[model samples]
Target: MLKNVLKSVGEYKKETILSPVTVALEVLLEVLIPYFMAVLIDKGINTGDMTEIIKYGMLLVVLAMAALAFGALSGHYAAVASAGFAKNLRKRMFYKVQDFSFLNIDHFSTSSLVTRMTTDITNVQNAYQMIIRVAVRAPIMLIMAFFMAFKVNSELATIYLWVIPILGIALAFIMTHVHPIFVRVFKTYDKLNNVVQENVHGIRVVKSFVREDFEEQKFKKISSSIYKDFTKAEKMIAFNAPVMQICVYTCMILISWIGANLIVGGTMTAGELTSMFTYTMQILMSLMMLSMIFVMTIMSKASVERINEVLIEVPDIANPEKPVTEVANGSIDFDHVSFSYSQNPEKLCLKDIDLHIKSGETIGIIGGTGSAKSSLVQLIPRLYDITSGTLKVGGRDVRDYDLEVLRDAVSMVLQKNVLFSGTIKENLRWGNPNATEEELIHACQLAQADDFIQTFPDQYDTYIEQGGSNVSGGQKQRICIARALLKKPAILILDDSTSAVDTKTDAMIQKAFIDEIPDTTRLIIAQRISSVQNADRIVVMDNGRITDVGTHEELLASSKIYQEVYYSQVKGAADNE
Candidate 1:
């Protein structure tokens, strides 16, 4: 755990070193304050000469003021440095997760990844801050306190020999009992995040199905788990303050008893005894601070382990060694490609899939619900690595090109649509950052979005709510299509993108694509036969295998799979109309 955490922080070696250097400077000042108290007591109070007492007293004042200035300076530096480290860590983790292929993402849920990025990052943040300010100071103050007391009187320092070990034992017990709860607490957080995330995203489905009561109960189960685990950890740790206080009080009383006897014996002077008492108290306080740091360190260790899991996740799909730079032409071929989501590999998502798509051709992929239509398109973008076989994009192996270059050559409009909160223009600008107003309008016109967008008072400049909540399903799909069209990549994929639009609007949108995007190769996946009827070729799929392939007319005549799809969907559409 320590090795992994240090490794991530080590990525910013200069910043990591600067952080500790700054913090150590600040804590050095704080450590000196108690030392001045000893000096003031021993030099000024015990001495009879007013001149010597006044001189050292003024010097102590100067030291205190200087320490304060340095402390403030160190604190500012630490905050800036720690914040910069955390920002870099967040950026790296986000990019790494994005770089991960689909099969890798499948190993962790969306909610879990969110928790890793957010809660786990905060956990690391707290530790980073505390470690900078407190970690070294606690131990340094502890050692210095004992040395100061030993200088005043070795006998009095011996009292700590007994008390410190008992404090250690108590702290050890707290650490042991709290460690397991920390692990369980993260799991509870995962459950809570999953429930809340799903409920919020799928609120419409829950309401339509009238499952509000069921959803509430489901949330209760997860939330209750979080409450229970958090309480358990808190209860165990709460014992530390009172237990440490009792130990300190007991030591204080024992020291008073021994010191009183020494004072009566005239062996220990009044000023000497006073300084010893102050030093002992400083030692006790420093020990408390040290123990608290240890507990915090333990908590962060657990968090670090969780975060390190993600930080160390090696994407199965390696980035290209010497990547291709040129824009790939819209041509793809799968040479006996076989793949699965899992290493234990329960069931293959695609098996022995061999297909060729020529440049500028339109291919419609038809499949049953689990027939891997979306999965097949995912391969062209290299979202997942094939288990066995060669997959080529533009005559070169897909893995031979930089992922950015490969992705830039293709655009995929997913079945699950998402839109950021921004003006329509801003959201669409995501597709083409340098696009002009005219191009935006043309793309919107092609996606059949211009009409609805213009109905609003602001048109293209109109603001959209998060997730495009102000729009209907068809409207969102059109906007999503417009965004993809603005990119104008060599290959365009519409994965059930037209499902929300009526057949007539769907046909109109298809017409716009054919008219305007004449040179781009297209792949459209849909359950409706009409959506694909005009495609250059159609591939019918079932249960992860290609069952038939041909043009619309050829398939209706010869292929059983294509004929069944045509009969079911075309007949259904005709009856509806």
Candidate 2:
């Protein structure tokens, strides 16, 4: 986990190294101050030499200023290194998510990923700053201070050796017990974020159903879980401070008692006793800092594992070696293809099937909800790989071509129409970034979207709310269709994309496809029989299998499933009239 996380510290290596170097220098200067004060008190005051006092005091002032400079520099570098490391970590995770295939995304929830990038990264950042500064300073200060105390008088120095082990054992006990609780706490944080996200995104439906009370209850349950876990963990961590204070007081008293006896016996002077007291505080304070570092490291260990999970995950999809660069045409072939979202052969969503579509042909597909109509078309863009058999686009295996090149040649307007928060023109430009104004207007007209767009006060530049909530369902669908048309793909697919528009507009959109883009193959998946009656050929699917394929009239006479659907829709239309 440490190896994986350190990779994101790119370019900050200089600051990372410099922070500890300055901290060590600061510790060295601090250690020298106490020793110099011992010289000033013993040789200058006791022996009545004013020159010794003046010389050591000035030297002490210079050492203090240098220590201040080093401390400030270390703090500045630690801040820079930690914040930069966090920024790079977020950027790396987002780019990695972009590279993941649909299969990989299914393995992790949207809310879980958000929590890892945000709360988890912040914890790691705080811990890293502490590690570079306090973690470095503590040990160096402890060693240097202990060495000075022993040099002054070895008997008082032995006090620290006994007290250090007692403090160490107490800290180890606190750390081991609290770590598992922190792990549980962070996982609950993921659940809390997920609840908030779901409520916010589906607030409209929740309000319409009057489920605000229910949502509040659910949130409280998860939030309360986090509170309980945190309180328990903090209670365990709270043991640390009291234990540290007890050891500090015990060591100070022991050192004072021993030094007083030694001084009266004529072996130790008042100046040496004062220095021993100073070293005792420095050593104990350093031990306290180490305890704090250990506590932070335990908390951050959970965050580190969560972050490394994302950083180390291998993208499920990548371009093949020696990939084909071009797609010759829109012709597609599915040779005994089968697919399962779980990648398990026994639970395939699409059964072994064979279908071939020629360039420039208009094909209509009708099926029940689980018949895998959307699943079939999604394979063309390589959104998910087939589990078995060969799936080819432009007369070559889909896995053979570079993924970007293959996807660019195919445009699909899915069953769920999505529009981002931007001006109408900005969203349309997603299809073709460099599309001219005339081209944008032309594509909208073909999709039967130009009339409604013109009615908006800002026309093509009208602002769209997030998810296009400012527009009606039908208008959102039409705008999405226009965006796909702007791509001018070799193959155009409308997967129930016209369900919101009136029958007349749907017919007009279909007619525009025939009149304007004769050489581009079009695939229409719809539930309405009227939508597919004029196709060159229609496919009838049942239970993940294509039961029949023919022109509309041929299917009406020969395919039982087609006959049942066509009559039911016609009967519903008659009854409405």
TM-score of each: 0.92, 0.96
- The list of candidate 2 runs beyond 4 A from truth reads 43-53
lDDT of the structure predicted as candidate 1: 0.81
How much is the lDDT of residue 239 in candidate 1?
81
Best-performing candidate as measured by TM-score:
2
**Each model's lDDT:** 0.81, 0.91
Off by over 4 Å in 1: 1-53, 343-346, 570-577
Clashing pairs in 1: none
Across 214-282, the per-residue lDDT of candidate 2 in tens digits comes to: 999999999999999899988888888898889889988887888899999999999999988899889
